[model samples]
Target: MSTVLRSIRAAYCTQAVVDWLALEIETARPTQFQWLQRTLADHFGDGKRTYIDSIDADASGATTRFLVRLNDDHCRTVDTVRAALAALDQRHTLVGPALVKLLEVSLDFYPKDDQARAYLPLLVARLQTSLEAAGGTSHRLVGPTKRAEHLDSTDTPDPRRTLYINNKLDPLAWRVYYKITDRDQTLPRDQHRARVEFTLQGVGLHQYGINTVDDLAALDFGDFGHLLHFRQFKPLPDLIANMKPELAQLVQHATRRDRNMISLYPFGLHAYRRYNTGKHAGKPRNGGHPELRKHSTHTTADAELNQLVRNRLHDLTQFFTQNWNEK
Candidate 1:
């Protein structure tokens, strides 16, 4: 597997000098935001909006936030981020270092094998089930409503496409989704792969000790790696391998269809319940059905998937640290 820090949205809080200059720009030419955005974009890269693609200023002109997309191979470095900030500084002319605020980080994974492809959907389903199991009153699901006073322009998130773990307004919120489809030709045919993405946002970045670009540059795999998990659904043989002799015999004598059904757990249990009570034999007993359930279970994905994430995270960290020690 391979991983990349696909994007980040950070804000540069202007100091007093730039604040006055920004306010002056806003006053003299209320539409300078767009022009400034273009200037900064041009200064940072090819001026084609490929690197520092998004730029904007707040009402007070005290802060400017930009979205940086590390889309190209040459731009995947901490130096790129620093260069982005430097571009902003050169254009804004600040007296001191800009107060950097990280709003979100998107980590994208490209699976090399079929393990992640097979497991990702199941993993998402499990996460959704776990969230639903938490019930409605859970704070993880609830947040302030957006109304007349609290109107904010945000995309209506599609639950089917993205598995959001918590309310977006929470201190820390994240989501996972597959970014590529069969029709997507953004990359080469062999590289046309399952792009599983995990996004982290809000002040949770601070809680995770990611305060600055440098912190992100030095992030450890364990810092945010624990968020990804998988559940392995064992095969039929493994599911029933430990049953007692009589139980195993009862399971063994069952038809291949029934054995296959048993592998699915509770679904198969229903059929066995009827058989154990002699319902099929027209001699059903009152509450005589033996209790049966799936006992064998695994919490972790296969080793291949686990190591894939670890290796990819290492690669991502290496990208940030490659030019890190030089300057």
Candidate 2:
């Protein structure tokens, strides 16, 4: 950030304003429970006996699910509420880890004294263009209003895609990858399937010792077959059979309790917290100003970042090849 532009933003972007907008947009998406479950399943690891609650699809095509925390009794109380509020406050001020990583890498590629912040407004405009091309809107509080009061009730739209792709990626707030649902008959970003969803009826059936797929046959769901109608069993059976081994490998890899979810080692999240705290306007362009000394030396060469990206692609290819060869 240049001294001039930095001063301009510093004069305007207050923490409270950033937080208020973040709360509006985040609350508009699928709830945090859904974000955690879906993203964890996709990016982290999945375990058995894990289930999703009945999903009621919201306007953004995002769905809601009852987050089942097994030890619910210990979860309730004043502390949990306080923690949630605090976390939200923190999150509203953060940028995503992946994005910060991108900025740090790009730093080395650009000139040492460059003000990357100047290009940001242009970049964000381009982002809105790309999102519109992909059938999404860049949230605008625009109206035929000359008055601030008119825009107050103007909604911040539900974020419906990954923050990287969404024009609404608030540099001011933590990035939460949204699970977009474009339409009905679309699979939710969450891993809930018709057969696996915990329903009011599913709860009733559970009392009758009908829980697992093995137990499904106990009830000849004659007239009630519509309950299972959403399970598209045709290609999925073969797909599962084919992909099971690779999926097993992925789960094992992620469950190692490592930062391999991002495929990065010695991750910088601890230091990255400084950016969330608003200690620096951005990761130092090239190690930043003297004030940024407390931040970890943040830069990944372009080649290294490229290599990390390619490594993930290669991991996918190799997984398929090795599994197929075994077959």
Please, what is the whole-model Cα lDDT of each candidate in the order they appear? Answer: 0.39, 0.26
Query: 1-327, model 1: which lDDT tens digit per residue?
Result: 012111111111101000000111112222334545565567655544433323465564433444444343324465765675566556665343332343343444434445544444433333332221111111221122332122111222222355444454555444444444422345553342222333344465567775556665566644544444322335446646887888767766773546323212211011122234355342336445454322213222434443445555665566555733533
CA lDDT, candidate 1, residue 300: 22
Summing lDDT over every window of 10 consecutive residues in candidate 2, give the lowest-scoring window. 98-107
Candidate 2, position 319, lDDT: 31
The C-alpha local distance difference test score for the whole of candidate 2 amounts to 0.26
TM-score of each: 0.51, 0.17
| Local distance difference test, candidate 1 | 0.39
Clashes of 1: 0
Clashes of each: 0, 2
User: What local lDDT score does residue 249 receive in model 1, on the 0 to 100 scale?
Assistant: 70
Query: Largest TM-score belongs to which candidate?
Result: 1
Residue 55, candidate 1: how far off, in angstroms? Answer: 11
Off by over 4 Å in 1: 1-32, 47-75, 95-164, 170-178, 181-191, 242-298, 323-327
Maximum-lDDT candidate: 1
Q: How far is candidate 1 from the true structure (C-alpha RMSD, Å)?
A: 14.1
